[model samples]
Target chain A: MIARLVGDAAGVMSGGVLIGPGDDAAVWQPPPHRAVVVTQDALVEGEDFRREWITPHQLGRRCLAVALSDLAAMGASAAWCTATLCAPAETVLDDVLALALGLREEAEATGCRLVGGDLSGIRGPLVVDVCAGGSVEPERALRRGAGRVGDVLAVTGTLGGAAAGLRALFGRRPPAAAPAQVDAWVETWRRPRARLIEGRRLAALGVRCAGDLSDGLLVDAERTAAASGCRAELRLEQVPLAPGLRTAFPDAWGELALGGGEDFELLLAAPRPLLERIALDWPPELAPITPVGVLREGSGVSLYADGAPLPLPRVLSRHFA
Target chain B: MIARLVGDAAGVMSGGVLIGPGDDAAVWQPPPHRAVVVTQDALVEGEDFRREWITPHQLGRRCLAVALSDLAAMGASAAWCTATLCAPAETVLDDVLALALGLREEAEATGCRLVGGDLSGIRGPLVVDVCAGGSVEPERALRRGAGRVGDVLAVTGTLGGAAAGLRALFGRRPPAAAPAQVDAWVETWRRPRARLIEGRRLAALGVRCAGDLSDGLLVDAERTAAASGCRAELRLEQVPLAPGLRTAFPDAWGELALGGGEDFELLLAAPRPLLERIALDWPPELAPITPVGVLREGSGVSLYADGAPLPLPRVLSRHFA
Candidate 1:
C-alpha cells in the first residue's frame, strides 16, 4: 500500500537519494561536507485539529508544513520526509490516499521527497506524525540558544491569521467578521507554509538565533529568550498582524497575535545591524520580516504597547500548557 | 517536559552530531563518506500490543527495536533517532519519562543517539512513532529486488518465537504448556532485537538481497520473490521454529511459525555459494543463519514439506489484510 502510494520519490532533493522508497529503508547520499538537521512533529485529530475544519488533504499537508517548520527555523533545505499515518479501520481508503497525496504534493513543492513511512490501524483518533530532514552548512544553521542579550527580534510574514481562523471555525465571534476576511484566515490556518527560503536567507546573512512561532510569538519568543539566557521585551503595537486581522478582530487581535499559535512564522533574533542588513538584502519574493521585539538582560518575557507596560495575554495553544 | 527527558543526546553515535537536543532540530555531521539510510515505524497502544503484556519501558524499547529493524535489513548502522510520543492527558509524567528512558537506553545500546522529538496530548490511545537514520556504504546495501534466480534464501536467528509469543499472550489454548517455555516466548514477544550487527556483517561479506522478517517467513519470502520477480520455494521441514513451539502447541506450530508477524529477524536471499560462505564464516557472537528455501524463475511463493507441496497458511498479520 505504501509503495503504491509513494510510487517513485519525485526526484532527489539535493544530494541524490540512492534508494527510493521501496527497500526496508530509504538511503540518501547527502550533500558532501554538510550537516543534517532532522525534526519530528505530529497532529492528532481532536487535540491538534478537527475533521470539520480541515479536510484530510489539508491535514496531511499541515503535517509536513508543521514538521518542516522546524527545519526552516534551522535554515535547512528539506531533503526527505517520512510520515506515519494511523487511522481507525473504518476510515476510507480514498481519504487515506488523499491525505498521502497531500503530503506528497507538499514534499514535491518543498524539494523534498517522501522517502519511507508506515501505515497502521488505530482504534483511536487519527494521528499523523511527520519527520523531516534537511541539510545545512556546518555552524550556519539558526539556533534558539544563539540569541544574544542585545539582539533585536523580528518575525517573517504575519501572525494571528491562524488563531483568528480557529476562532471563526469554533464560532467564537465579535460583532461580525467580514466573510472574505474569515475565508482568508481559514485558508492561512489550513495551509501554513514553512519559511525555508527565508530561513536560508537569514542563515546566509549571518543571523544567528531563530525559532518558529508554532506556539504563538510570545510563547516562542519566551522560549527563545530562555534558551539564549536572556529576557525578551516585545512591543506588541509594532507586530505585523496578518492582513485584515486588525480590522476583523478589533478587540481580540492582541490576544490572537500574541497567544494564538500555529502561525508557522519564524521568530528571528540578531543584532540590530545584522538584522537591518538582512532586511535590506531580503528579496521581495521571500516572506517579509518586521522587527517587533528585543532580547535584554532580564529573566522573563515582558510586553509593552508603545512605551506602556501590558500584561501577557492568555495562551491559546493546546500544548499541554 | 521533553527537554527534561531528552536532557542530552547520550553520546554521538558514529561521527559526532554537531547540534544536540533543545533546538529547533538536531544537527548531525554524519560520517562524510556513507549514504544515510532512514526508516520509520510506529506502535499503537491497542493495535500493536496490549499494555498488560508489556511494561512501558519494554514498549518503548520495542518501538526502537522495530524501527531499527528496518535499518538492519538495509545493512545500515544505527546513528540518530527521533521519537514522537502522543498520550492521553491522564497519563503520568513518570511513565512517559520511563518510556523515554527505555528509548534512550536502547538507542545507547545500539550506538544511536536520541536526537529530537515532539510530545503531544492525544484524546485517545497512546501512540509512539520513531524515525531512525543510519549510515551505509554506497552500493553495499542489501536490497529486496537484488535477488536472482537460483539464489538461496536464509534467515538470521530463529523465527516463530514472536508469533508463538503472541499466541501465548492471547492465551490460545495449550495442553499443559511448560511454564518456562511460555515465559520464554512471552519474553521474546516483549523484547525482539534488531539484527544490526548481522546486517552489517552481511553487507561487509559482499552479500546482497535481504529484508527483515517482521512478518512471518512465508509472507516475507513471497514479498521478496515478488519484488525480485522470482518464485520462492520453502521447505517447511527444514524451517527453524522457536524453541519448544512444536511441543507446546503441536497443532498450531506450523501456522504460528509461518504466519506470525513481528519476529524482527532478517530474511536474506543470496546465491548458494555466498550463503554457504556466510554460514561457514558466521560468528558465534552474531545471530546464526540457516538455509531454508530457494528462488526460481517463477512467480509467488510455494511451500513444501520435505518436497511434498502444502497449502499456504492464513496470514496472521493485522495490516489491513
Candidate 2:
C-alpha cells in the first residue's frame, strides 16, 4: 500500500527540508516574492476513522481540514489543494460525489477551491491524501524556530474533547451519549477548526513563535522548546481541559488533555505585553488565549503542577507520532 | 494498514473547502490570487521503483519531477513542494538525507523549494508522495477544456526512451551494454524532467489547451479531446519516438510508443500560427516540438495508421488508471 511504502522511505533527513512535514502547508522560499507552500496528509479507513463514527461528508471534511491546519500553523492561508483517492469499484458514485462536495465545502470555508486531483480503484480499504498551498511573506512568517526566552506560551482552544468523544463513541465504560450543547472537545476531533483567523491575529500582533497543537499540548510544547532551544514550562492548572471531560473520566481526562492527539488548535507565544493584548481580544468560547507558562533560557520542555516540576511522559502517542 | 483506513473513509471533510480532490489542487482563490495550480503523484517501492533502478536521491528527484510535469502542462512555474515518505525504521540515515538533498537540488533547478513533509515507519514497500504548487495568472491559465476544433496537436519531448530503458534493464532481450549512452535512457525513466520552459514558451505563443503526457500520448490526447468535446486525429507517423526505441524493437516500437507511460512530456494543441512560434522558441534537444494532428468538432479520440482510421485502446498503460 502507498501508506506502507511511504513509511519505508520516511527517515529523519536532517537539514534537508527547511520545513519538515506537519504544517497546513510546506513552504520553500524561492527568489523574489514567489514563495509557495505545499501540504499533504493521508486518511486511512479503520485507522484514521471509521464509518460508524463519521459519514462520508464528515470524513471528507476532516481529511481536508487536517491538511489545511498545517498551513494555518505556518501562518499561511490555504490557496489550493489536491486529493488522491483509492477505493473499491463498487462504491456508489453519489457517495464519492458527497465526499467531493464535503471537501469542496471545507476548502471554500478556508478560502480555497478544489483545483484538481486523482481517483483510483483498490481492492480493500479507502485512502484520501490532501495537499494544500499558500503564500508567505518573507519578513512576517512564523516557524517553530522563533520562540524566545520568557515568551508567553498560549493556546487558542481547550483540549481533551475529541479523545472524550472517541471514548464516548467506543463505549469505554458507561457508553455515554453526546451532549446537545456546544461540545468543543468532540467538535475539535470531528471537525477541527484550523487556526487561520487566530494565526493572522497573532501575526498582526508580531508574534513570531507558533505551532499547532495537533499532537497534544505536551508533546507539541516539547517540540517547540526543543526546536527553539528554549525550555517551556506549562502551568498544569492553567492548561485548559474540556468542560465535561473532567466530570466524565475523572482519572484520565488530564492524561488525555496532555497526551491525546488530533486537537488541531494553535499554540503560539509572544512577549508579555503582546500576550496581554491578545488575551483582551480573544473570546473565551471560541479561543480562550491563556498564558500557560514561559520560555526559559534552557533546553527541553517541562511541566509544573502548582509550583512543583513534574516529569514529562516518555511514551509517544500512536496517532500524531 | 493506513492505506486501508484511508480507502474506507474515502476522504475527510470539514466546513469551507470549496472544491477538494478532483482537480489539479484545491483551488481556494483566497484573497490576492484568483487561480492557483497544484499537482501531486506518489512513487511506491516494489511498484514504481526498485533500488537497483534508482538511488534514494534520484527517487526523491523523480517524485518532484513527475508532479511538476502537471504544473508544466498548465503553463505554470514550479514554486513549492512537499513530500510524504514511508520507509523502514532501520534504513540508513544517509539514504534519507540524500533523498532530501536530491529534492533540494531539483527544487533549486526549477526555482522551487523543499517545504514541509511527513515521515513514518511501515511494514514494507516505500512510497514517496510529492505535492507541488504553482501560480497562474487568472486571465491566462490554460486547461484541458480549451482544446479547439482545428487546433493542431503537438508534443514537447522524445518518447519511448523510458520504456525502452525498462526493457534494457530487465533483459527481455540481450541487454545494451554501452553503459554511458544506455544510462541516458535509464535516466529518462528514473529522473524524467518537467518541461517548464517549454510550457511557458508555448503559453507565450498563445497556446491555451495543454496537458502533461504522463500516461502515453494516446491516452492523454483522448483526455484533452473528451474534456474539450472534440475529437483528436493523431498522425502515428508524426509521433516522435526516440532513436534507439525503433532500432531495439522495430516491430513493437509503435505499440510501446502508443501505450507506454511515464514520459513526463507535454501533449498540447494550438492554432497553426501559434504552433510556428512555439516551435521557434522550444529547445530542439529537450523537446523538439512537432505538430502531430488536428482537433475535430466531435467526440472521442482516434489514430490514423497508414492513412486509415484504427480502433483506439480504451485503457491507458501501466501505473496510471
Candidate 3:
C-alpha cells in the first residue's frame, strides 16, 4: 500500500534527482559551487496537531513546510526532501494516499523533489518527520551570528495570525470575531507558508542575519540576540499584527503577536540603510517587510510600546522549556 | 535539557560540516564532482524495539548504522547525519544524553559527523528517525538495476547471526545453544555493523549491482532480481552461516539464514571473472566475501540445496504485511 501510494504520488521528477524511490537511497547531483543546508523536523499527532483540526493532505504539506522553514531561515533554495511517516495499521489507505499527494504538491510548488521516504506501522500517534536539503552560496548564506549592534530587525508578513488560529481551534472562550475573520485566522494556522522568496532576496541583497519565526517573535528574537552577542529591543507598536487580531483579542493581541508560534515568516537583521533600500526594492508579490526592532549592545530582549517601556509577557516556547 | 545534551555531545566537527548544532540548519560543503546520496530510517519504541531489549546507547548506535547501511549499499562514503528523537516528557535526560553519546561515538568511528537534530516531547512511544547524506561517484554507484544475467552473486560477512540473536531474544521455543552462544547471538543482534568498508571496496573494484541485506537474503535478492529484470539462483549450501547458528538450530538455520532481517551486510552481483578478481584484491581487514548465488535470465528467486531444488521459506517482512 505504501509503495502504491508513493508510486501514485511520484509525479514528474524535477531538480537533479538521479535516483528516486525504490532504491536503497535517493541520489541527487547538487549544483556546483554551493553548500548544502540540511535540517530535520517532526510533528507528532497530539503534540503538533489534532486530526479533527487538519486533513491528511494539509498535514502532509504542513510537515514539509515546517521543515522547509529552516532552510528558508538559512537563505537556501529548496532542492529535495525525504519524509518518514509512522501511522497505525488501522489508518485508511486513502488518507495515506492523500497525504503523499499533498507532499508531492508542496515539493513541486517549492521547487523541491520528494525523492524518497519510509513508512511503518505504529501503535500510537501518527508521526511525520521530514528532512529537507537545499543549496546556498556559502559566502552569502544567512547566519544567526551575523547581527551587529545598531542593526535593524525586520520581519516579513504579519504575525499573530497562526496563534489566533490556534486559539480559535482550542480556546475554551470562543474568540469574539466575525466568521470571515475567524476563518482567515484558521487558514493562517493550517497552511503557513515559508517565506522562501523573501529569504532568498535577503541573501541576494547581502543581508547576513535571519531566522524563521516558527517559535514566535520574542523567543526567536532572543535566540538571534544570544547567537550574535547582542540584545533585541522591540517597538511593539511597529509590529505588523494580522488583520483583525487586535479586534479579535483586545487584551491578548500583544501576547499573541509576541509569543504566538508557527508564523513561518522570516526575521532578518541588517543595517538601517540597507533595510530601507531593501524595502524600497522589495517585490510586490512577496510579503511586505516591516521594521519592528533593533539590536543593541546588551543581552536578552526588551519591549517598548509607543516609546514607553512595557513589561515582557510570559513567553511560551515550542520545544525548549 | 536537549540543548545542553546536544552541546555536550557536539564534539569537534569534521566531514565538511561548516555549521553544526544550535542553528536553523546545518551547512556542509560537499566534495566536488560527486552526487549526494540521501536516506531516512526510523526506529520506533513498540514497532522497532522495546525498552527491555536494548540499552539506550546500543539503540542510538543501531539507529545510525541502519541508515548508514543504505548509503553503503550505494557505495557512498559516510558523510554526515541528522536525527530527530521524540520521547515522552517523562523520559530521563540521562538516557537521551547517553544515546547522543553513542551516536557521536559511532559517527566518529565511521568517519562521519553528527551535524544537527531535533528533540521533541511525545505522548506515547519513543521515536528516533535518522537522515544520512553522503557523496558518491554517480558513474560508479552500486545500483540494483545494474545486475546482468550470469553475474555471480556475492555477500560480505556471514548471515543469520542477527536473526538467531533475535530468536534468542523472543522465540517461543528456545534454542538449545549454550549460555555463551546465546550471549553472542544477543550481542550480534544488539550491535549490527554496517559493511561500509566492504561496500566501498566493491565500488572501487568496479562492481555495479549491490544492496544491503537489511531484509534478509530471500527478500532482498528477490527485490534485486525484480529491479534488474533477472532471476536470482541461490546455492543454499554455499551460503556462509554465522558461527554456531546451524548447530544451535539445525532445523531452522535455513529459514533464519534466508528469511530473517536486520543483518547489515552487503550483497553484490558481478560476472564470475570480475568476482574472482575482486576477491583476489579484497582487503584482509574487511569482512570476507563469499559467492552464494548467480543471476540468470528469468524472474524471481530460486534456491537449490546440495545440487537439488529446494522450496523457498516463508519470508516475513519487517514492516509490510
Cα lDDT of model 3 by residue, A62-160, tens digit: 999999999999999999999999988899988998888888788888999887877877888899999999999998889988999999999999999
State the displacement of the C-alpha of residue B132, model 3, in Å, after optimal TM-score superposition.
0.5
Off by over 4 Å in 3: A1-3, A8-13, A171-175, A319-321, B1-3, B8-12, B171-175, B319-321
- The local lDDT score (0 to 100) that residue B299 gets in candidate 1 is 95
All candidates: TM-score: 0.97, 0.80, 0.97
What are the root-mean-square deviations of the candidates from the true structure over C-alphas?
Answer: 1.8, 9.3, 1.8
Candidates in descending lDDT order: 1, 3, 2
Candidate 2 docking: what grade? incorrect
Expressed as tens digits, the lDDT of each residue in B1-321 for candidate 1 is 777777554344344678878888999887868988899999998888887988889988999999999999999999999999998989998889889989989998999888889898888889999999988997899899889999989888777888877777887646667878888888988998999999999999988899998878888999999989999999888788889888887778888888876878898889888878878868998889988899999999999997899999886783422
CA error at residue A287 for candidate 1, angstroms = 1.0
Which model scores highest in lDDT? 1
- Residue runs of model 2 more than 4 Å from their true location after superposition: A1-38, A45-53, A88-95, A121-125, A135-140, A166-187, A315-321, B1-36, B45-53, B88-95, B122-125, B136-140, B166-186, B280-282, B313-315
For model 1, the stretches where C-alpha displacement exceeds 4 angstroms are A9-15, A318-321, B9-15, B318-321
CA lDDT, candidate 1, residue B232 = 97
Query: Candidate 3 docking category?
Result: medium
In angstroms, how far off is A108's CA in candidate 1? 0.8
Per-residue accuracy of model 2 over A244-316 as CA lDDT, tens digit each: 6766676676777777667777777688998887777675555667678889988877889899988775432
